[model samples]
Target: MIVIGIDPGIARVGYGVIEKQERLIRPLCYGCIETSSHERTTSHRLHEIYTRIQVLFAEHSPDEIAVEELFFTKNVTSAIRVAEVRGVILLAAEERGVEVVEYTPNQIKLAVSGSGRAKKEQVQDMVRRLLKLEEIPRPDDAADGLAIALCHINTLR
Candidate 1:
């Protein structure tokens, strides 16, 4: 089965693609989609994210999309923007007829690192080990995206 994981944000949205073949879970691709904060309006940025993700769905044909749910942040404005981008991601999945699953930050950390209270480095290291990567996925957001997918695949197991 193929799954794509998303870590949503206003300036950058991270994505990771993975496949479960037999007993092994492998990473296919991982990266971030970035939008400039200077030239675009928030709505335009959301549309661009939505469009790019739709292209990803077409290219990957993933069976499911695993997304990290919003966590409370002290910055209300930033949190709200993240939420909006997240909604756009979910809408893209729905339009592509892919099933969507959500995981909280704690749940993702637990599933990926064996501890809900695991630090970011721990989770990233676990993701590298689990996916058999040579190094931790670049750009912390992308690593978090992989963690989200790994979380879903582990849950299935």
Candidate 2:
């Protein structure tokens, strides 16, 4: 099974693809979609996000998509923007007929690091260890995306 995991944000949306087979999970791809901060238009940024995700769906051909659910302690504005990005990702997946699953940040952290309250570095380290990668993915968002994918893979077992 191939799964695409998303960590949504208005400025930079992160995505990771994983292929699972017979108890093995392999990283297929991981990256962030960055929008221009100087563009002076939120709509343009949103359009860029939508278009990029659409292209990613086509390129990866994932059977399913797993995305992190919003968990905001504060900053309602940030949460709303992230939610909008998440909606765009879901729309793209739905249009392509891909199954969508949502997971919380704590759920992903626990699945990846065996602790719900694990630090970001811990989750990233475990992701590298489990995937047998030599280095952790950069910019934090990519690692979070991979963690989301790992959570889904672990849950299926």
lDDT of 1 at 133: 96
Specify the poorest-scoring 10-residue window by lDDT in model 2. 36-45
TM-scores of the candidates are 0.97, 0.97
- Expressed as tens digits, the lDDT of each residue in 46-119 for candidate 2 is 88999999999999899889999998979999899998888888888889999999999899999899999999
Candidate 2, residue 119: how far the Cα is off, in Å: 0.7
At residue 115, give the lDDT of candidate 2: 98
lDDT of 1 by residue, 91-150 (tens): 888888889999999999999999999999999999999999999998999999999999
For each candidate in the order shown, give its overall lDDT on alpha carbons.
Answer: 0.93, 0.90
Clashes of each: 0, 0
Estimate the overall C-alpha local distance difference test score of candidate 1.
0.93
